[model samples]
Target: MSVEPLIELKGICKNFGEKMILNDIELNIYPGEALVIIGPSGAGKSTLLRIIAGLLAPDTGEIYIKGQNRQGLIEDKQDPIGISMVFQQSALFDSLTVAENVGFCLYQHSKLPERKIRQLVEEKLEMVGLPGISHQYPAELSGGMRKRVSFARAIMSNPDDSRYNPEVILYDEPTAGLDPIASTVIEDLVRRLQQAAQVCGTYVMVSHQESTIRRTADRVVFLYEGQIQWEGKVQDIDITDNLLVRQFFSASIDGPIRVIN
Candidate 1:
């Protein structure tokens, strides 16, 4: 792991009108690591992901990318380095074919020719294990296929050759709404993508799924009540005695975490 942080969140605080979503979040995302943020629903996990992706600006905080201040700068627009986001919903254009969706960024941003773009798209599709379906539209594909297509689109560029390939990929609920089998497939793909040499990058994911948290995280952060309650390594989760952590992992409602009716 690199000593220098790939992404940093310093004093991140977000408020939606009157409700506080995130409170004084301080974090360091290292290079080539899978950092998973786990939290209950409406805990602002996705909001935090958006902030890191530079989609949403925090009310008060400093976002540093490779040690450069990125305040008020939307990362997607005029970002110095590559950062990609896989949204909770597979936000694909239904009209566009799988190939078009995967290659959209390349065609719009790069000077690469159509043939080269197509080739890159095919390569990415194959990387996600969904080759030969490029000609098909998103409507015809399963939910899992659409999600993988979104991933391919996010990582289609080459990180070493060009600055366009994402150095960091933010996943917002990657395995949401999928059956156990399909969820396992998505989890396997995420693990494979991070380990693959061709497109390995730092990944930060927000999920409520316990299996996803265990399978994909190199480190885990538990966000609740708009703050980080506890955080530790993936293995430590099983041994920790923290009330919130134990209750969360075991799905025990008779502990410190109470549901108000």
Candidate 2:
């Protein structure tokens, strides 16, 4: 049986002054799937993500969460219905230690005890392959470590509390600015998270990294010029004859895509 979409977007549109960022976009993200949105720097990939995260309001369109109309609801204010974001910049608090940062959401939103929160934090860190650094501050951690910490933070939740567990985790360039090995670690962690029964949820990631797209995506959506230019299963990307897909994967300069210099 086909699973119902966890999140759905319809007639989505956005404008920044005179320039359009997204245009009548439609998408369905299914449960237990990793959907990756990809495009170049100016392709509005991030804008699409922010709109889905409810960080920015769209000029027009509707968002459905679990088949419920949510266009009128505001994020954070409405409690986002089990949605979380792992930012491209890591977005960690320098003043807070790893443990504190990881548990920040739980402390703010839930009535969980401190000791239990700390235990959950440690488990999340360990899951992301970064154990025993909970006491260290974010500033002390390397770039890769900090990214992993953000991943841990995104996945941390009370085992007994379903409200604290995100049903959709949106990753904005989770592997950006990391070395190959570090990138691989993040990729593996993403795959693991999607399959893990304890934390499995529908995930949507926006990234430009070729390796990241190849390694982490179960489905791929290629957004360009304010629309979804192409989409298919991850394996279809390599063999698909779509010019944009071919040029993007091959990194060829001779295609129809023109680079601004």
Model 2: ten consecutive residues of lowest lDDT: 71-80
TM per candidate comes to: 0.95, 0.95
- The lDDT per prediction is 0.88, 0.87
User: Candidate 1: where is the Cα deviation over 4 Å?
Assistant: 75-77, 158-161
Off by more than 4 A, model 2 = 76-80, 159-161
> Which residue pairs does candidate 1 place in steric collision?
none
Residue 9 alpha-carbon offset, candidate 2, angstroms: 0.5
Evaluate candidate 2 by giving its C-alpha RMSD to the native, one decimal: 1.6
lDDT of 1 by residue, 1-261 (tens): 539998899999999999999999999999888999987778889999999888889999899998888967564455667888899898999999999999998767787788888998999999999989999999999999999999999888852346786778899999999998999999999989888887746899999999999999989998988889998999999999888889888887788776655
